[model samples]
Target: MSLSLFIKYIHLFALGLLGCYLLRYYGDLNPVLASVLCGLLFSFLPFQSFIKSTKGQGAIYAGTFAAMSSSRVLNSINDFVLVCILGGLILTLFEGRFEGLGGRKGMIAFLAVAAFYMYRSVL
Candidate 1:
């Protein structure tokens, strides 16, 4: 990925992680509420131009999905960050496809989480 794209991915990844952590700690550990509240908070940020972009929004979804794995799987911050980055990479990889489909973001997040689980288990 280009430097700009890579930077954007990381930005979005952080936003996602922030949302997840915020909700996990402050929002009663509800993934649905986490995503919703984070989405709303992000939408109102000053960086609306970037936040409104396709990749931008998708990155947040991917981040939340990745780190939302059960405690049984993601036992550490390392694991959480890895899965989140994996989701970000995957999101950036397929950022342009499936525009007409719903739940594609969740699907991508599932793939990232499953991949990380298999990686942690198989290795």
Candidate 2:
């Protein structure tokens, strides 16, 4: 597979695992906010160089946040803005809750996004 595709798959897998973790622990969190917190933590964490040396981790987090909020608003512009807002809210709500689990947060964010998409499609 091409490098980009490979990276995307890996990111997707990471998100899936994150979702499982969230389900196991903090599934009660609002999906949109959880995704934002996950994205922010993943982006800012200094462990990028030690493992998975790619900026895609940040993208995965951001994408998950976006996906989670995509269902609430239909307008494309509004959707993007809402995603960011939701993410921020999540970060604020669960501040310092998962200090050492950036990866787990990412998975939860992914699951939230997936759940949003699933709900949107079903309705």
Identify the candidate with maximal TM-score: 1
Measured against the true structure, the TM-scores of the candidates, in listed sequence, are: 0.84, 0.36
Weakest 10 consecutive residues, lDDT, candidate 1? 62-71
- Model 2's TM-score against the true structure: 0.36
Candidate 1's residue-wise lDDT over 19-47, tens digit each? 77668766676777777777777767778
Among all candidates shown, the one with the greatest lDDT: 1
Model 1 misplaced stretches (Cα beyond 4 Å): none
Model-by-model lDDT, in order?
0.74, 0.46
Alpha-carbon error at 60 in model 2, in Å?
A: 1.5
Kindly list the per-residue Cα lDDT of model 2 for residues 46-119, writing each as its tens digit.
Answer: 65452243435543554454444333443354334333433333433443465665564455444445544565
